[model samples]
Target: MPQTSKIFYQLKPLLQYVPSIEPPEKRVPLQDKLFWTLGCLLVFLVASQTGLYGIRIGDKTPDPWYWFRAVLASNRGTLMELGISPVVTSSLVMQLLIGSRLLHVDYSNKEDSALYTSAQKLCAIVITVGEALAYVVSGKMF
Candidate 1:
């Protein structure tokens, strides 16, 4: 196992578990799936509009890349300021690393596969905090 993979396994224990939907007992109707998808989208949009608690007192600067926040699902000073940046960025890097063969992990192995997934989540979380701090430190956000 490479250093990165080992770190993921080690960190997994300390990370909070996000509850997700388990496998369904049977296939859902297409209409049901569509409604669920739409509902989730609505929720996401609403959340994005919501402001962050206790983060209302910040000097708003012109974001050079304000467009990315929407694409990344991040809202300024909101609960989702971290948005999906961490997950998307981490996944992208991991895919590239895996594709370039820089980090060797046998996808065929279950443990290795789990390690990769866990690593992605860990990397995202770390990135969320790092980016948040960077923004505040640089006076881009409060």
Candidate 2:
């Protein structure tokens, strides 16, 4: 086995007993823009769909609001500057670490399982809250 596959093989059985974590079921789309619009709203919390498209490209004119609006539209760019991006980037790093046995969890032990569960919850919370704050404070939504 390749080193990566071998590492995953060792951890595979442990993950089986770690308990499945599922996101809450969301409302099914009804072939209408309503749900899609709502979903976008949840993500952006913006005024309207049209308003979102207007801010896409940075304005050329020397308007003060142009920079402000661009910063809002480029949410990831703004978040990158605010030091929140690493928390997100580190989550991916942690996944690679877990897969590579750099952060091994001995799932055979109940305590270890609980620790893994808590870590997962903590990661989820941080990502969710961080994204929400980024959307709201950066004015990216609307």
Candidate 3:
């Protein structure tokens, strides 16, 4: 077995508690896949339009994230304000760590791969919560 990063070893105990979707027991048909995809898209669209309650938008305040929001498909003062940022950011961080040799991961090994994935998910969750807290603390939603 190749040498793994200490960080990965330390996180191993917590990985089991991370929520994950199980793979389908059988192969899904194309039509079913399409239906599910569209269903999720519809849900996301609806959620994007659902504004966060009690968020006061100041008219005179210039939107600093106008262009940033456009690129991320996020709606200001909405549930999707965080957008796909947490997932993207976590993936980038993990990739950079592995690429820089800061975190050694053997992708060919099943255990190693699984651990790396769980680590990414954990990172994403932490980032999402951190971002949400920052928004509230900084009064960015106002």
Top TM-score prediction, candidate number = 3
Off by over 4 Å in 2: 1-94
Model 3, 1-142: lDDT tens digits are 5465667778999998888777899999999999999999999999888878886444557778889988888878888988989999999999998898888988788778888899999999999999999998998565
Model 1 residue 30 lDDT score: 100
Candidate 3 global TM-score: 0.89
TM-scores for all candidates: the values are 0.69, 0.35, 0.89
lDDT of candidate 1 over 1-142, digit per residue (tens): 6664565567566544632245699999999999999999998878777786656725466666579877987877776777888888889988998788767677888767666676777777778888878977897465
Off by over 4 Å in 3: 1-3, 56-61
lDDT of 3 at 32: 100
Query: Which residue pairs in candidate 2 collide?
Result: 46-141, 46-142
- Stretch of 10 with least lDDT, candidate 3: 54-63
What RMSD does each model have against the real structure? 3.7, 10.9, 2.0
For all candidates, the clash counts are 0, 2, 0
Compared with the true structure, what per-residue lDDT tens digits does model 2 show for residues 1-142?
Answer: 3343344445555545545546548865577558778786666533322233335424344543445444434332232222334345446765777887767766786656555555554555567578668866988543
lDDT value, candidate 1, whole model: 0.74
